[model samples]
Target: MSYSTLSSRTVLVTGATSGIGQETARQLAERGATVLLHGRTAEEARAAADRLIATTDVEPRQLHTYSADFAHLDKVETLARQVAAEHPHLDVLVNNAGIAAPERHTVTADGNEVAFQVNFLAHYLLTCLLEPALTSDPGGRVVNVSSALHRTGSIQWSDPNRTRRYTRVAAYAQSQLALTVFAADQRVTAVSVHPGVCDTALLPLYAHKGISPAEGAANVVRLCDPAVEIVNGAYYDRATRVEPAQAATEDRTVKRLNKLADLLVSRSAA
Candidate 1:
């Protein structure tokens, strides 16, 4: 089922040039909802938007593009301001861009771990900057793309920055957990989806896990569809019945997680 009944809603999708993101943009456009396509490069973002317009009834002006490498929080901030200034009444934000690299302990420009900043912090800052627009409607949706990796992950309160220690899979898992908790803490209706192991290049983060990108994208799109609007703060997979996340369900736990993120961002800014 289509998520928006507004006939003309604006949706922004990150990492939209490839994989699940590309597919979600296509599906959303086909449903007649405007979609803002996001990618790392300008050419790629524009091309992806153009392709969707060609194949779907999406109005040409309805499809927009924003480019930024998630490796830098400055870029995410810039993108948020640019988007908000351009489209003042954004109705949805799919914080879906993610990357996993096993070869090193990557860091963003702010010196935060790469996976933590790109996969998690970038979304956090983006949502915070756009809070006015989201809360304006109260019914606005924020669909966060977390993962099932948290089943094996735990919050490392002592070292979330991975300043002293880091493992590729562990850091990736930790970031997903952090993102889910953050979503649950926000005022607007927010939910996280763990697109099960899919054949996306994202799996190479584990150096072996694999599943088709289509299968991976299924859940992300499901969470965005209007049918699940009442599923605020829930975790979902595909179109299955919604489920509560352990962290989201636990008040004290989510509070702590938010506190940690707050401290990290404060220090990072300092």
Candidate 2:
């Protein structure tokens, strides 16, 4: 699919150092979009950017790199600020950075579960901060890289942060669920996507069963296409729109999650 509309647009893809995110950046650049490839560190980001420029036919000037550790909310804030300052307008924001179920439960310096922060909250805060840039254009889109596993998740209101007890699967599900709900609640053209279990490092054991990173990225690139009109707040399974878990569709739940997310980000900034 040719995304001629993307020519001259600015896009930011988190987790572009590898997997679906990297492929998504490459494909977008091929469509003539200026891509901001994000990684956890400057070296990682630069390396990824260089590889894209060298391997793809896209011009070197079309690719840029930015780095921030999502585990620390403060760093996420810094990333948002830097992007806003550097780019006058952001046409697309791909919240593709994520971690799968970890073998052991871990907490970040921000006092939140690692999966929750990295997979959901960081993108939430980043999108909030970048709203101005996104809305500056008429067709601004925020494509959140979510998962079909979100159907298995329910918010643990009692322990949303997983401070008391934690399981890798539960934490991962909850984070993705929150992300879907946030997409639903956002006023902008935001939508969540399930890349259909790509073979990424996030799930090494399941690598044999899932599709290739390029296939997963195709679905994401489709959503970013300016010609496609997105059903605001909907969850997509590749090219098809599918229903998420019942909890993800509840208005009360979406509101609650948004409130909690705001509080978390505000606290981290403080």
Candidate 3:
């Protein structure tokens, strides 16, 4: 894509403290977009921005740092409000923040599985809260950094947190499945992507070795480009657009996931 194509565009990338999220922020900044770098903490966000400025031609003005702990729905709400108030005309939202499920069952203080809440629930709440700002412009869109493992997953509608039975891989895959299903929501122009098994903190969940985060990030950045026309709910494996798991593309699943997410976040469907 042309470097100038992203000029004046404002993109928010969550979990930008390291790995693919950080690299996505770096690449977007290099492409001349105003990048809002989000981290689990303020310090991490600032550090990511510092590293980007020091290593690349990105200037401080081209980066903004934001932080919120996704394990808490309240923090996610606060983050949405902050971003919307400061940058009311956001161009893209890259939901790249995620975590691997623990070997043992665990739940956040919000009473949900750790990985599910951090990976999907938080993004759901953030996206809904930012709908006004996202819809302010015609081409505004959301890119969900989902995973290939979603195909191995199924949502336990009755026990989303897997309170009855839980395994780390199953928990993580379920989160990714929910994220992919969420892209089908008609509330925003959105798509989901499996950026390949990149060498990141979550790599242990996939394999021992993998591609670089920068390589994985390029695939994500491509979808964020306004020059690239995309159909809402499209799913890509790396750069190739392919059909997602059958349930992910179903309208019933989309609505069902949205309803579940709304109840989990303790908010009405937006």
Query: For this target, which candidate reaches the highest lDDT against the unseen true structure?
Result: 3
Candidate 2 residue lDDT tens string, 1-270: 545657877899999999999999999998889999999999999999899878878898998899999999999999999999999689999999998757787888988888899999899999988888885466688999998778888778778888777778888888988888888875678899998888888665334678889999999999988788788888899989988778878888887887788777774432
Q: Find the candidate with the highest TM-score and give its number.
A: 3
Looking at model 2, the pairs that clash are: none
**Candidate 2 vs candidate 3: which has greater TM-score?**
3
- Residue 35 alpha-carbon offset, candidate 1, angstroms: 0.6
Candidate 3, poorest ten consecutive residues by summed lDDT? 1-10
Kindly report which residue pairs in candidate 1 clash with one another.
Answer: 3-225, 3-226, 198-211, 199-211, 199-212
Model 1 TM-score (2 dp):
0.88
Task: Give a tens-digit lDDT track for model 3, residues 115-140.
Answer: 99999999999999998888546667
What are the per-residue Cα lDDT tens digits for candidate 1 across 70-154?
8877788799898999888887899889888456887766778888888887888888788777634654799888787765666
Ordered list by lDDT, greatest first: 3, 2, 1
Cα lDDT, all candidates? 0.76, 0.87, 0.93
- RMSD for each of the candidates: 2.8, 2.0, 1.1
